[model samples]
Target: MPDLRLSRRRVLALSAVATLLPRSGLGQTSKVARIGLVQSTTGGSAALYGTEQKQAIELAFNEITKARTLGDIALQAFHADDGADRGQTVNIFQRLIRQDKVVAILGPTLSNSAFAADPLAQQAGIPVIASSNTAPNLTKIGDFIFRTSVPEDQVFPTVLAYGVRKHGVKRVALIYGIDDALTRSAHDVQKKAVDALGLESVGIETYQRGDVDFSAQLTKIKAQKPDAIILGALAEEGAAILRQARQLNLDPKTVFIGCNANISAKLFELAGPAADGILVGASWFAGYDTPRSKAFVEAYRKRYGTTPDIYAAQGYDAAYLIAEAIRRAGTATDSRAIRDKLAGITDFEGVLGRFGWSPERDATVTPKVLIGDGQAKVFAAAPAV
Candidate 1:
């Protein structure tokens, strides 16, 4: 955990250098390629998740910058704490664009922040890639807005389908936070998937963003005795739901399925034994047996002193994808050119698996399922449709 803070003078100096460098100087001159990272550092139960995400981004940057081949394209990163505030996110993005003049933008992990900063990036003609923001509306932002992480529209359907098909789940209860865009999107997708499968959504419960108590929601859900309860919220709400469900002694034989946010180690820490049997669906797992994945996991652990989560893996993959796009475009100077190159990516052997992008779906990689108790195992692969 090296100190991630950059001094004001250093940021200013770097900003000045980035603005002054000519387009032709990229990858040939001494000027470093600056990347602006905006992530939430306050409020949400997922704040620690954001911190872990930042650590992963820095880890990838550190590894890439240290490589001899990347010497010409020094990867410098600037971080902004959006605190899950949309207004703060917009303000920070404007600052990064107007003041820092970053070549690309990396995050603002939540969908709300991604929604806010994405348009700003498009307006400024810079490419913005999100690691974890999964709201369905995010993909519609513009060509400038891209997400390495799978959108909820893609993730939730697969999760629900798996629960219904593979696990033989008949009835499901969904608990979601109304204020969170990702959760709402997941709920909608799950609802559709459940209906399509001819399974009953016996229970549906809602909560506010900052609400810690899910007793009422859990009480309602527990009474339904559905075959499974799908948690469609961030880490904090998910943890609360588990804790309250446990406290109520409402352990339905029904399996507990969770969205991507439930993959966080903090969720297990917060929920303790209650989180043991929880099922998580995600695009990448650090524990995957692939050589590239193993190496990435080992390097990330060596650098950060903890196991890397999917968010970290996604960040690393996003950086690598950006670098590859730069390589294909033959220069890092033109953001639009780099974006065009990225849009054409196919069969990219990334840590997350082979990445292929299309206008209809940005991610072509199949997602994996894992249990929260111990090492994750792939439950199923999403068939290429």
Candidate 2:
């Protein structure tokens, strides 16, 4: 990977200022700092994702506190459950930034919520490290906006290319939730890839996030008999669509391809056997073969009595990112220093393995495809490229 650290000239400038200033940047300053963790803990199906993310964040923070990850500076997390409502997200973000005076924020869970609340943080010039917003142009929102989630632009084309080659997919259809920003953005990426691959566009369908019935959409898709139905939705929403499609017998031969959105327990629990035979590409897998990843999985299972999914992994790594940035910046209260440190990160080994930032401040990360097996409530390696 190319080095994404700041240029030597910028580093020299910062160093010069550090020499003139008296103890404010890194190790010289020690103060308590507040961080906002905004996620949807209540609003319907979204809690499936937000809950895991929240749990993982807490877990990571607990470990960091025990380890004194920030040295003399103490970090306090202010958790808020936005209920997956855009209005509530904005309100929570405002409170966190203004009243609580947090230096940084972790999330609002969904990309829809991110789009809704990120601007507030940008306006205030606070750093926002999102854990699970995968839509395109998310980091482009501003310099303060960064995400650990791999965008759909990077994830879809590769997954689709593999699916088409391995499964002989000739015709494709897209079913997405139009109400949510993440799914809408994913729909755009999937459509572009379909056209690029020269696949026939069979049927396109849209739904809201909480809708339970997809019979109408499934019936229309069944008529086209596309080889694959690409889903651009969160776990619960996608599960409902898949279960409904199976009930309609939407061509048993037709398989499903999903983005990171479907790689969660919600899909396994809600869709049951229907989740099997689906292809999914995600930035993190619970069974990833890395020492750090294995330890994380083992610890999570022992604590929660259940395996953590991609969202949990993202949240866990995000917490580590926050603490590491504060340590590098040498001040928990300096948001700009934290932001620069995050952008300058050359390598960070976490549950996601080695990680860094792109020039645009998006995560410079690679994704792997995992196949769903109905019997195991978890994803396994795709077994092939």
Candidate 3:
């Protein structure tokens, strides 16, 4: 019952509809809803993904506002960059909640940043929808915190299971970032999945977030000669590892299982042909053959002149989710009301497909798996996970 009206496609052209609507001020009674958008738009490893997220969010807001999706409530966005740093993220959260007086907030891109920053939003009664952070226990921060990005635990297992069935993977090695909440949680889930699937553990290696040389880890993993390697690192680190592994002359048949972060196009750019065999667990993929997902992909390509990835898809859905929550709450200014309505959303047709909240307030959607294209084009769909 959490407002399904906005999910349906609009019949009227947005330009045509805009002409009939009144302005926000100057004798017009329409209200402007201020929302804060936080992400690592620059000065961080997540900058590429963050930049795309910002672009998609702005695109979604443009479309929503043009269509008058929230009726009289026109959205006013206040975007901030946290540089993917925890310190900057917390300060931005405080500033958005207290100074800007935003009813809701989205992002603070990395999971470590979210862990450090979301508590402040929770204390301030501001609802936050995470477009990118997918570490475990994210929503456990409070009722006020939610995420359009599904948790690592929910999707990684399915990815591994699919790998086992299709690739006949048995012995698996693991590598992950120890310093990041996202990578750490991804590691934990991948390990758990490995154990549950009764796969042999040949080696487990760890690295810091910014390390470039994975030669030592790859050498050790190569000696073990596992059927597959599970990666808990993001695209940048994962790319480095893949290139180094290829240089080390690891087995050609060895498969690579990557987390949600490795779905970025930057991975292929950095790793070159070394990225050919990766299978990534993700919340969304560009070529998904569903109505909502296809529409989103086509719209995004039309607007941005580039195909949308998982990050862009996440941002677009997050914007609409917030807009829908605002509409259902009936008061754009009430943070608590909006939070409640957002948590109550049981069915939302998003680019990620039929989106909903898990009991943990994390996103619940059928996860998609992506594979390399044997060329520059990567991330084609594998079966749904």
Flag regions of model 2 displaced more than 4 Å. Answer: 1-30
lDDT by residue (291-311, candidate 1, tens digit) is: 888999898888768787788
Instruction: For candidate 3, write residues 152-222 as lDDT tens digits.
Output: 88888988999999889999999999998889999999999999999999999999967999998899999
Give TM per candidate.
Answer: 0.88, 0.91, 0.90
What is residue 361's positional error in candidate 3, in angstroms? 1.3
lDDT (CA) per prediction: 0.74, 0.82, 0.82
Task: For candidate 2, write residues 75-159 as lDDT tens digits.
Answer: 6677777778888788778877887788999997988889889999999989998888888998888999988888889988988
lDDT of 2 at 111: 88
Better of 1 and 2 by lDDT: 2
For model 3, name the residue pairs that clash. Answer: none
Give the per-residue Cα lDDT of candidate 2 at 269.
87
